[model samples]
Structure formats: C-alpha cells, structure tokens
Target chain A: MGGKVTCTLGEVKNRADFIVYWGGNPAECHPRHFTKYTLMQKSPFLPRGRKDRTMVLVDIRETKSAKASNIFLQVRPGKDFELITLLRAMIKDQPISEAQVAETGLTIEQLQDFVSRMKAAKYGVFFFGMGLSMTRGKHMNSAALLTLAAEMNAFTKFVAMPMRGHGNVTGADVIMRWQTGYPFGISFNRGYPRYNPGEFSTVDVLVRGDTDCAFIIGADPGATMPQPAIDHLAKVPTIVLDPHVTHTSKLARVHITTAPAGISAPGTAYRMDEIPLPLRPALKSPYPSDEEVVRRIKEALLEKPDWMGERPQMLQNQI
Target chain B: MDLKVIDHATCTFCGCVCDDIQLHADDERIHQAKKACVLGKAWFLNHTAERKYPDALIDGKEATVDEAIAAAAEHLYQADMPLVYGMSNTTCEAQRECVEMADHLGGLLDSHTSL
Candidate 1:
C-alpha cells in the first residue's frame, strides 16, 4: 500500500489476466480508455487480448462495459456490502439462504459463478471508482473490495486500485500519500497525517464548514459537489488552478491557470485500471502544470514550517 | 446544401468533455459525428431538447448571460459566505476560472459529484 513501483502499460498487458471495472463507465467518462489500453487493444502476450482476457463489469447499472463484458454483475445501489458478503459466502462454499440472495438481487448461483471466476483468474485487477467509495457506504465499500481481493489471494493473485478521474488525481493521491501517509480525507491542520475518511473527506469537510482555506489544483469540486457542499464552498478562501471559466473557476479567488495534462502538459497518470502511463501533450497552452503549482506549494511549506508538522519516522515512511 | 467539416470539437454532453470529436455539417444541421460515444452523439445530433443555449433562466423567463453572470457574481460577492460550485461537466479551463473567482471573492468551491 505504501511503496513506489514503476511499470509501463505494455507490462500491465503482459501481467493481467482478468480486468474488473467496478463502478466505472469508461465509455462515458474515458471514451478511449478501452481502445488505448484495456479491452479492444492488442497486448504483447495477449495478441488476441479481448479474447484471451476476462473482462468483468461491476456496477449498479447495466452500463456500456456491462453490455460488452464477459461477466457483468449488477449490484443494487448502495447494496454493495450485501453483494460483497454474498460473494464472500460463495467463495467459502457456504450455503446461501434465498432471503440473502433476494436481498442482493442476485441469485446464489450467480454469486457462485462470479466467485468461481474470480478465484480461477490467473491475475485479477479490481478497478473501483468514486461510485463505490463516495456513496452511502463510502470507504466501507472500498474496504470490502480490498478484503475480498485479499481473500481471493489465498487461491490466486489479485489487486485493487481506484479509478481516479482527474488526470492528476492519482498523482495527487500519490503526492499526498508520499507526504502524509494518507490518501485524501487528510488534514494538515494538526501538523500530522490523520486518516479519517468521513471526517476529512472533501465533501464532509466542506459540508461541515470546517476548512477555511482550500487550494484546488487540477480538480474542481464546485460543479461536482452537492448543493450543501457547494453552498459551503462559496464561503471559503479558495485557490484554483485551471485554464477556462467554469462553475468552480467563477468562484475561485487566486485562480492560477494551468494546462490540461495529456493535452497541454506531459506527465504520468494512472489510468482507471491503475496502470501508469506517460501522457503526451497533443497541444500547448500558456498556463503552467499543476505539478509546478504543487512544487511551489511544497517550497512555500518548506519556508513556513508551521504549515506542516513533525511526524514519527514510521509515519513519514508510510507517506 | 453545402457541406463543411469541423475538427477537434468538444462534446458538451458528459463530464468526459471528449474534445477530439469531428462533425460533418450541412447548412445549419450537423449531419454526423465521429469519435464520440452514444450519449455524446445524441447530444450533438439532437437540437430539439428545449434548447439550453444563449439565454438561460433561474425560474421561467429568459435572462442574458451578462445578467446571469452579474446576478451570480453579485449574489456570491455580497454574501458574508458563498459556495462556488459545479465543475465535472465543464472543461478544466472553465474550472480554473471558477477557482480564481472563488478565491478572489473568498468563497468555497467544490465539484458536483454525479457518481
């Protein structure tokens, strides 16, 4: 969970056997994700990649991925826990009651089928999105998925990664993790990294009106947050980095223009599948990249020690 | 009708904001779209969805973009507190503009979570 590893998309293609898309619609969000890296593309080992590999889609709706999946499991909204539990039960070969099956809207047979497929895969990768981690169950959903993947390892190989949307969101998470032992939902006020998802999560923090100053980088929250959160954001001191006039840009205070990664600035980004790729900027823009802004922030923090606090060596290592 | 081709157009449909789409136009009509998804195709092809362009309204009657921008700016500026919102559906450039306005006006800015 806390280490630096570098690999190319070609390597990922060579290693992966099963690709699971959890709570993501690559077709709708990342139109070229599949064409460039995953499903439809040809890989080194998997010359007939789409045919050689198993593609699983786990979402609430019958999405485009589901329509094209070798295995599509539709979980009821906010009922991911029940579905995970059912999968766990099936993995254990324990008898599942009809009532439990009905609760998940999935028959025991279907659950067993999924469990068997998951268990049999040579290498399974679960790519979950905010849909699984930011909803009613929140982190619990992620925890369950991680736990299931951990459980699966008893029989085979498995890994889980979040399908971060912002071009540099995974980069942000990596930076935060490297700096503070925590990914998102972090607080620098206390001078150390504190991991409290619900308490420190962006939504809860804004909705609770806890943060007075916010530095928003490549990401925008104003247009994507709930009304309550948005209402709260309108009152805080915010720093924005973007290139155009957006709902969030309209609200920013110190707006620092930045070029879009992959289009205007070259950088590394983790695809929705957790495979890191080098983004080749197709065009140039006048703005700087978020990386530069963050580097400046780091310099500023170094100048003002009060902005950050002392931490244990173990915690520092974790970060 | 004469035909024209446009390259590197942005899709105004989803948050993906797929900007590499190409459009074939015949007069005022868009004949076809390429490099877009099902949702994007529908959005670009269909022009009869009540027309959410030019003038927008908060409650009924039409209002100019200037009026809306001013009203929104005043409402945000005047508030002892204000929340600057919505970013997932627009381009990253627009998001930057929003963040600057928020900071300048001392407001909170958050992205709307559609997921």
Candidate 2:
C-alpha cells in the first residue's frame, strides 16, 4: 500500500472520464489551469478539448468555475462526507432518505443528477482541497473520498488527488515517501517514519507541545493555521526562511532571507492539477536555496547514521 | 561587459507563475521583459524596488544586518521554545537554512499557504 510510482498528468487525463473539482476553486486559485492543462487545453485523445470532457464543480458556494461548469453540486458546509456517502448510495441505485438530502441542503433531484453523471462517466477523478481536509473531518474526509473512488472503480475508473496549495507540497510528500515511506506526519524521534496525523502532524505536534525543534520549508502555518496551532507555534523554537516578513517571520527565532521560488531559485513544484513544473530563478539571492539546505541536512543525516533508519513496521500494522 | 537576453522563464509575482517569458538585460539592469502578464511585468520592471540590505530591531530600533543576525542567533539560542514561519515567498535554499536552525533549536516552522 505504501510505495512510489512515477506517472504523468497526461496519463491521468487519458484514463479519466469525469473530473470533479471538490472544495477547490481552480479558476480563482489556478487561473491558467483550465486554459493550459485541464479542460480547454488541447490533447491527443480529447481533440475537442473542453467540449470532449465532462467537468463538474462541487463546492460550498457557487464559484466562477461552478458558473461555467456543466454540473455544479453545492453541498452545505462540513457536509462533504455525508454527500459522498449519499452519492455512493445513489450509485448503488439505493434510495436516499429525505433527511440526508435536507442535511446536505441538496435537493433529491440534484443528488440524483450528480450520481447519474458519476455513473455515466467512463472514468472519473476527484480533486479535493484543504477545505475538506482542514475542516471537521480532516483525514477521514480524504479517506472517505478515496474510499468512494475505490468503490466507483468497480463500475468505472475513478481516482482522487488532493489539491495541494504549496508549489512543492507534493514534492515534500514525494520526498518524504521516498525517504521514509510515509507522506507526512512523519516522526524521527523513534528513528524511523512513524505516521500519525493527529500525533505527528505539524498542527498536532505544535498543539500538543510535543516538539521542541521545528524546521520549516516552503510553508507558512502562522497566517493560515487555526488559533490553537498559532498559539502553540508562538511557544516553539522557530526558524523562518522567506523573502518578505510574515506573521511567522515576525515570531521567528532565526530568520533567513532568501529569494522567491521560480523567481530567485530554480526547483520543481507540483501544480494544483498534480503537474510537475520546473521553477526557474529569474534573479539571484545572497542566501542559499531550500534544496541546498535539505542537501546539507541529508549529508548530516548520513554522517549521523543513527538519525536515519528503516521504515517502522508500526505504520503498516496500523494500516 | 555586454547585455544578454534569456528566454523561457517563469514569473514570480502571483499564483499564476507564468513560465513563458523573455528577459532583456544590459549590464546591471533589466531593461525589458516580453510575454509577461501585468503582474509579471511590474515584478520585472520594479526589480530595483526590492530590498537587498537586511535590518534588525535592537531595543526596538533599526540596526545593521550583522547586528540583526547576531541578535536573532542569540534569541534563538536562548529561547526555550520558538516558532519559525514564512517561506512561501522565499527560495527553497533559504527554507533549508531556516529548517536546519529550527531543528537545531527545536522550534516550530511553517510557510505561506498561497505560495
């Protein structure tokens, strides 16, 4: 269940029949996405592009993408899992209770239509965001979506991917997976990758006051994280690397200024659509790049062999 | 000694991060950029506006870069617990340094959500 595989967005596009944008507004967040890659872009199989593909937008509000979508399912706030379950029932041709429809604020007709579209599609893809993962459900919401996708595969092809916001968040996940066999919420305290979201995740670690040291990369939880996480962050030994001063930088113990990604540093960032794009530095900065720092840490880890170890069996056992 | 032109680069102003761009430079200054969106254009043309020198607050006063770095290092070394944040706008290189320092000091670190 835990392994690494390399594939292209083109392959995913070829296999997908329906693309569902859930809890993410690609239009506002990724302006050129539809024009460059997802819907309107020209592809070998989808010669007609947007016309040849089915686009559905699932959000809490009616967004610009929803306005342009062929199907828009506006689920109530924090009701994503419930809606997914109801849709699952619909896919199975089972009757859904009116109470479930009322709870989700989606009419029976709307639910029926969404389920019909999902069933009719030859292949389907769900691109979800933090809106679903950061809310009441967190990882369980992701698990539910993945489970739904897995179930859908019995009738038609379906897959799900998180709409990672950072430029290299996917890269971080990829790196961690390659090195530790876990994506995130990784622990080195026991000398291996110990995967526990609530226990080892950045927020959990900070909230519980379990960590004494924190090394942050291309991410900022100060401005975005919940108040509890922020409060916890205020009490930690923090180091910041950024071009501009931010809330986190203001609280940093050691602030190292550097150039912006894709502007002053060259690296690879996974786009919202899970496409790997090269970031080219247009200018130079006095400080080193994140890659250099990670390389140094890796060298240090190599020198201190005890700090690095084989993947812990606990994660597999939990699974 | 002479000016140079580069092609196929990404713009860093906004989330778009448009990669198709050309840069024209002469000696020490970038004269013009082509095929850049409005945000990218402003970013390239206003390169001089970007800050190079670093400053620090010593007793709530602006101090030299060295003073700031020293103060920051001292603060980190002395603090029982600290939080390091913001890397969305910076290069990964700086992020690496910040991360190392956090690990050494056992601090909390994070970056911008939009970057």
lDDT of all predictions: 0.57, 0.60
Docking quality band of candidate 2, CAPRI definitions: incorrect
Q: Where is model 2 chain B poorest over a 10-residue stretch in terms of lDDT?
A: B106-115
C-alpha positional error of residue A92 in candidate 2 after TM-score superposition, expressed in Å: 1.8
In angstroms, the error of model 1 at B94 is 19
The sequence of per-residue lDDT tens digits that candidate 1 reaches over residues B73-114 is 433344443433334322333333444343334434444332
Q: What is the TM-score of model 1 when looking only at chain B?
A: 0.69
The lDDT leader among the candidates is 2
Q: What DockQ would candidate 1 receive versus the native complex?
A: 0.06
Off by over 4 Å in 2: A1-8, A12-17, A272-276, A293-319, B1-5, B10-115
Please give the DockQ score of every candidate, comma-separated. 0.06, 0.21
lDDT for B32 in candidate 2 is: 74
A226-317: candidate 1 lDDT, tens digit per residue: 89877765666564555444476566544544555544455554433333444433334454555554344333333432212343222323
lDDT score at residue A239, model 1, on the 0-100 scale: 49
- What is the fraction of true interface contacts found in candidate 2? 0.14
